[model samples]
Target: MIAQTLSQLRQLKLTGMASALQTQQEQPGPYEGLSFAERLQLLVDQENQERQQRKQERLIRTAQFKLKAHAQGIDYQHPRGLQQSQMAALLQCDWIRKAQNLLLTGPCGSGKTYLACALGHQACLKEYSVRYVRLSRLILALTQAKADGSYGKLLKNLASFDLLIIDDWGLEPLKAATRNDLMEIMDDRHDQSATAILSQLPTDQWYQSIGDNTLADAILDRLMHNAHRINLKGESMRKKLNSLTQAEHLG
Candidate 1:
């Protein structure tokens, strides 16, 4: 019943709004059947809680996709959504289960970040812990920690998320110190925890983009040495959205 209601709500595109509250307000009674007031209280308790959970899920997914959109400079529809088949094997089918990383690369709007976040989401759904952060913000945070004598404190927390995402790699050149911080995280995650990286630059061009040969080499050696690489190929999602809007206008 829960699944059916969720499906119906999603189909009507009302999952993100407050209009569906009424439908969920009076949940079906249990096997023992309750009095009118009990049922009403149950509705208030169950429906409201479920609605909030759905809302939280939407927010989490939106945050994840937004990171991808920013990374690719495109919208969520870019890559036209990750076909379940493309990732079916990685999460469900269980392709090599090691501490290896997953790298997604493609042109702007190709869904690099979306794929990365989706993979992370899948991992969490499968009971693996996850953390999402943009590459630029990560660097900035590391820089601040270094200045305020809290580098270890920050890294200790980072070491915990079962799946860590380093999104939008190569958005800007990495300084020597920032490059080291990136390397440390990659090194620590190597054979220790899972990592997913989303980037516009291809693997071969990463060295040039990172601006540190030795550090880049170390990062790749640890991250790519045992990684699953997914290369997305498609037109820009922004262009596609624009075409759809134009079509609607013309129609």
Candidate 2:
């Protein structure tokens, strides 16, 4: 009977329940006292938990974040102008559901990228699809796609993500073609999907960096109008880590 039950579970693709049943049978002493209803409930719970874990794994795999950052692992001890309360609120991921944008601005090594990745991680935990791409690299890829006549398809793929993280914004000046490409992306995402931009440049300088005043206005109008800005300030985290390493070596 036990073998038949296990075979039925396997045929039904309830591997989690089958595994739990096998464990219960192996350690029968503990489960012997449980009622039949209780045993069935335990199997159901195990199956549901396994399914949720598998979903989270798939979401994380699809995200492709550069940093394996998590909201719980954020360093509140670091004086990087990050507020624990603000981060906690963002962790709920309500902003993403609302299709709002996040703008993270700070100097290099100020943890903008890490924070962005952390938020992306949280989004994945909530089962939201995410994608992280460096702005310069994305622009280059789009340019190449345009040459290959796959630009529209590429944009469509990007638009499908629930949260898009564009890291290293304003690292290079935007050419006319790139600016228009950016505008198109923003247009597609406006009021539809959430976008997070990590940048070393201040918001004021972004207009000039875009090069074309007209296209800049169109792009910024979509991105900045409904965005939450987080301006990080403090010493470089990289320099601090290097100093700590040197101190440890000396000791």
Candidate 3:
């Protein structure tokens, strides 16, 4: 009878509940005194927890973040101008729910990408869909999408994510086509979805890097307005870590 019930639970796709039932059958002593209603509630709670875990895993896999970072793993001791209170607020993901943007700017190797990825990870935990892509690659992909006649579809897909992270912003001058593509993306996400940009270049230099006053104004207006800014300042974290590793080897 127990085997048949377990089989039925599996067939019904209540795998978590099925596993819990099997455990209960194997070690009945723990739950022997509980009422049927209480035991059933435990099974339901396990099923809900398992479903939530699977969803979080799927969301993280789809995010494709460059670094495997978590909000809890952020190195606040790195002296990169990261404030604990600010990060705490960001981790709550209220900004994402409100459709706000984030800007992270700093010198190269100052942990900008890591911080962005950490926030992306946190957003995933909060059940928000996220995607991380470098600006150069995004532009290339947009150009390819245009050639392959999927430009509109691509735009819609890009705009669909709850959090869109663009790294390596303002690395080079943007061509006219790239500017227009960026315009389309920013316009679609404007006031509707959240975006996070990681850049080595400061925000002030972004206009010159874009090379078009009109397009820069439009793009910056959408991204910069109501955006949370984090300007990091410190020595290159990469080099610092390498030095520490070398010192440890010497010791």
Candidate 4:
């Protein structure tokens, strides 16, 4: 009867339940002592756990974050203006749920990209679809999409993500066409999805960087109207890491 039950579970593709049942039968000390209802509950719990794990794996795989950053690993001790209380509140992912935007501004290596990616990772854990791309790369890709007649389709696909992490914003001046494309993308996501922008430039200079006053106003208004800002102020984290490495070598 045990063998038949195992075969049936395998045929039904209940691998988690089957594995749990096998362990229960082979190493039955604790499981044997449990009532039938408790044993059944244990098997169900195992299957549910397995399903949840698979779902989270899928979310992470599809997110495509440049860095594997997590909220737990953030360096609160660094002099960067990151506040633990603010991060704690953001970790709940209510901002994404509310379709608000986040702007992370800092100098090079101030952990802007890391923080943005960390928030994106948190969003994925909360089962929100996310995509991470550098702004320059995104613009280049969109330009190519335009050439190939897939621009509309690409915008739709980008808009589908619940959280979009755009890193390295303002790395280059935008062309007129790219500005238009950006406005379209922002419009699609404006009141529906959340965008996390990581930029080395301060928000004040963004208009001049964008170059076109009219388009810049439209894009910045949509992005900043309901946005939360984090201005990271500290020495470059990369330089600090390099210095530590040099010290270790000298010692």
Return the TM-score for each candidate structure.
0.67, 0.93, 0.96, 0.93
Q: What are the lDDT scores of the predictions, listed in order?
A: 0.68, 0.91, 0.93, 0.91
The better-scoring model by TM-score among 1 and 4 is 4
Model 3: colliding residue pairs: none
Best by lDDT: 3
Candidate 1 structure quality by residue, lDDT tens digits, 152-227: 8888777776678888888888788888888778777778787878898888888799887778788888888878
Which residue runs does candidate 4 get wrong by more than 4 Å? Answer: 245-247
Candidate 4 lDDT over 113-145, as tens digits, reads 888888888888788999999888898899899
Q: Write the per-residue lDDT of candidate 3 for residues 76-142, one digit (tens) a residue.
A: 8998899999999999999999999999999998999988999999999889999999998899899
Cα displacement (Å) at residue 27, model 2: 1.8
Best by TM-score: 3
Candidate 3 residue runs with Cα over 4 Å from true position: 244-251
Higher lDDT: candidate 1 or 2?
A: 2
- Candidate 2 residues lying further than 4 Å off, grouped into runs, are 244-247
Error of 4 at 228 (Å): 1.0
Clashes of 2: 0
